[model samples]
Target: MSTPDRTANAPPLDQPAFARLPRDTGGPVFAEPWQAQAFAMAVRLSAAGWFTWQEWAQALGEQLRLAAARGEPDDGSHYYEHWLAALEQLVLAKGLSNREMLRERKEQWAEAYRLTPHGQPVELSAAMHGDHAHARVLGN
Candidate 1:
């Protein structure tokens, strides 16, 4: 399938930070820190040889196409949700991680986020594991 053209709304070259985004995407990309984090993680993983840029593009394109088919709003605000979904799919397909591992890690982060007081950063601690066994994973 042809990728949707998103260059019409991208931030211009004069805006250094946003210049890398496709020119058709809406201005003011990344609504939250986690969105940027997820984007960066995908890039980092790809750089680390987990997947190819073409594969990543195909996965994200498929996600966008599916969302569009579902009658979801394509206002671009939820683009990162599709990005994260694609990342999860790629990781699973590559056998880099499984659904259960992802779920458990998500639960750990959720618990950390929940226990964290508002306005404070969520951190995974040794205590969260009830032992230091998972401390190495946290270090990663």
Candidate 2:
């Protein structure tokens, strides 16, 4: 499918809510490092042609609506959770990543995080790769 215009689905920059997103010298602001990473990942995946901006918006909107239906407080604290759900859904739908692979990777990350010292950044190590199947995947 042809890529949609980049500017079409973007929230207006002048809007107060849009402005409230934490910002640096450029781009949208995020409350935390992971939030920024999630935002960047979505932008990168979209630019890589995995999905269109409109599709991403729809997925995110749907996720938010579902959360609201489930009685999630819609006070914007869970915005990134919806973003992550949308990204995961789009990724799985597009066949870019499977649930099993994502689950395995998540386990690896969790293991790595658990083993790391509090002040140090977590890094996946060979010791964390319990089996041969993940050896190559973890190596990268």
Candidate 3:
């Protein structure tokens, strides 16, 4: 899917909470496709009125702070991990999904990953049922 315009509704690039985001001259950079997907999910969710930008900044800041407190490496590799964590928390807090459901879906993805052959796309089993509306948004 096309990314929303950076010059449009995106938060300011200079925000303190975003200081550690991996970026280059053009803008934010992602080491993997999933990273950009996560970033876009956050931007879309916020714009959709799920949360305000300040709340997003605070949630992301808290995730980064917690990661630092736990002594995770400061390298940019984990930035999107923190972003994903923050997104999960925000979605849960907003009552979009419950903890049990989220846990199960995560486990499903883990299982699917383990069951897939190398370099092949991972797919959840046919028996799996998920909230496709939200799952699609989060790239689950």
Candidate 4:
């Protein structure tokens, strides 16, 4: 198997703020599949009337500025981290999901990722079956 082309999922560079995205000739480049997923989520959400493109741009720009202020190197290595943070913040502000729910879902994904065999797509159900989640909580 080969790595998927994450760039194919990249958001269109319509927003001027998107100029900050790391890109290649094929368009925006994502370091990971989840990064592309997050990008697409924001685009879809905005398109669905959850927010306007301008609001998304402002939130993303503010996230990048906050990261820079916290002394993150401007090497583009953590762009998706900031992207996810901005998305979470916006989602909270929009009342789409609360912090506790987000935390639980994140834990679910983390556990699934941990238990998954290499090269297999992780499944959330894998995190909850039998004693997998319980054992991880007990640090076993």
Candidate 5:
């Protein structure tokens, strides 16, 4: 999808609200103002069974500080990657999902890959081969 165009006279990145905006890959300038706000909303909604606008503001503020320290500038960044990271952080913070669940999912996927005939696992069940099946014992 085409991204919306930002005005040339757009406000500065460090202005009143933009100064504390979260970094997002999508939006006006890769990491434009509202992208971070959107992510913060999702995280807040998923946590504490609440969605206070003030809490969202605080979360974005903290996220902006952390991203800036990590060298995330006013320019936009990879939106989906940042979104995933935010979700992970919120999940961990709220204890919604455990590390073991993530690890288990990773291992299960790895095993599925290993069991596939080629290096890549086939998504269709009919794609599995029985080449390794033992031949019937002589005259059973």
Candidate 6:
């Protein structure tokens, strides 16, 4: 007997990759099914190699479990947060990224925030750094 091809067994990315939850029940701003769908689409696209999907999923799942354990009611966390948590988890699991990368990006945003004369923040993106840079600075 030979081992089967795992790649061939993999489900198509177009199919549902996650379970659905009641839209109206989980947190504000995510009270719509479309919002959840948007998050899912981002994850799926990242996983398909548009970026690092594994990293994103890892982060998102970790955040969700942490929130749940911290007494955050299931109804309280926004659906996007859960998606983000999973992303974080996947990142960490795959070593595609790390907390230091996140921390550094955050520090950059903070520095940008303080230096902006407009008392506003800056916006950071992968294009700005020429890499898959995470974190965003708003306002500026």
Best by TM-score: 2
Clashing pairs in 1: 6-24, 6-25, 7-23, 7-24, 8-24, 9-24, 9-25, 10-23
Expressed as tens digits, the lDDT of each residue in 1-140 for candidate 2 is: 89877887775343234235543465456778988888999999999998999999999989987886686656677789899999999999999999998999787787677667898878877325554546544555
lDDT of 6: 0.58
User: Candidate 6's residue-wise lDDT over 1-140, tens digit each?
Assistant: 79877886764454233546545534465557756675776667585775575556556656766776675655534657677556555555557779888777666666555555674445553214444333333323
Local error of candidate 5 at residue 37 (angstroms): 17
Per-residue alpha-carbon lDDT of model 3 for 70-128, expressed as tens digits? Answer: 86755666889999999999999999999989887777777667657889877776224
Model 1: residue 76 alpha-carbon error in angstroms: 1.5
**Which prediction has more favorable lDDT, 1 or 5?**
1
lDDT of 4 by residue, 78-134 (tens): 888988999999999999999988887778778878888999988888777675554
Write the number of the candidate with greater TM-score, choosing between 2 and 3.
2
Better of 4 and 5 by lDDT: 4
- Candidate 1 Cα outliers beyond 4 Å, as residue runs: 1-27, 117-120, 132-140
Q: Which parts of model 5 have CA positions greater than 4 angstroms off?
A: 1-57, 110-140
Q: TM-scores of the models, in the given order?
A: 0.67, 0.69, 0.63, 0.68, 0.40, 0.45
TM-score of 4: 0.68
Each prediction's Cα lDDT score? 0.79, 0.79, 0.78, 0.81, 0.53, 0.58
**How do these models rank on TM-score, best leading?**
2, 4, 1, 3, 6, 5
In the predicted model 3, the residue pairs found to clash are none
Which prediction has more favorable lDDT, 5 or 6?
A: 6
Error of 6 at 71 (Å): 1.8
Model 5: residue 130 alpha-carbon error in angstroms: 18
Better of 3 and 4 by lDDT: 4
